[model samples]
Target: MNAKTTKTAENVTRCLKCRRVLRNASPDGYGPKCRKKVRAAARAEVVAQYKPHQVAKAQELLEQGGLIPLRANRVFLAVSSDGSATYKTHRAACTCPAGIKGLHPCKHRIAAHILLAA
Candidate 1:
């Protein structure tokens, strides 16, 4: 909000919804200009948090341990920001809502990681 951080100045335009930075920003405001860069930064964070090879190795461990099924009718894929997988028995009981609602990450995601690693 100060002198337009190089990041803010480069990637974001206005906030997608607010219109101020999407709401009350100049046509070339921070969010508008920096949105893509911001998105890339976020993506990098996600990737670093969840290393694919490590998580896959964890899944292999789970398979060896037999905590996770190879496939399930109700089973949903859940991955966490920290590279954890979600494993749940049921949607209602699932820590991740089985993907019907709450897109936010949940413990089910962690469970999957555990299962994979087991």
Candidate 2:
């Protein structure tokens, strides 16, 4: 019974994703390698869901430092295409005209999503 209790405690210290033993368990339960893989998968999924042009735009925005995260990374301030304005951007919504018109997943939102995936 004592040995079984020790085994159970050992299992509790293993990673949720890979079952690898960790010296310190993370709050999300994934080990470092698994967390990285998960993030990469999320990024790939977001890229696949968007059009090539939209993904390109989002990448360009990131390269040009056009998106600024806010509210503990929950929101973003994205630069306008005209370079004269900024919009409040979220993963599901954006304050840009295209987003307001119900063009879901606008460039700003895509950029924000990419940031989150990263």
lDDT scores in order: 0.38, 0.73
| lDDT (10s digit) by residue, model 1, range 1-118 | 6565545444444432123334444432224434344334334433345556644543343223323233542353444334465444332334444334655333444334343222
> Which candidate leads in lDDT?
2
Counting only residues 3 or more apart in sequence or on different chains, how many pairs clash (N, Cα, C under 3 Å) in candidate 2?
Answer: 0
Q: For candidate 2, give the lDDT.
A: 0.73
**Candidate 1, residue 42: CA error in Å?**
3.3
Candidate 2 stretches greater than 4 Å from native = 1-43
Model 1: lDDT equals 0.38
Worst 10 residues of 1 by lDDT: 61-70
Taking the tens digit of each residue's C-alpha lDDT, what string does model 2 give over 19-117? 578878666555687667645744697689888888887867765657765677678888998799999999899989999997567888887787676
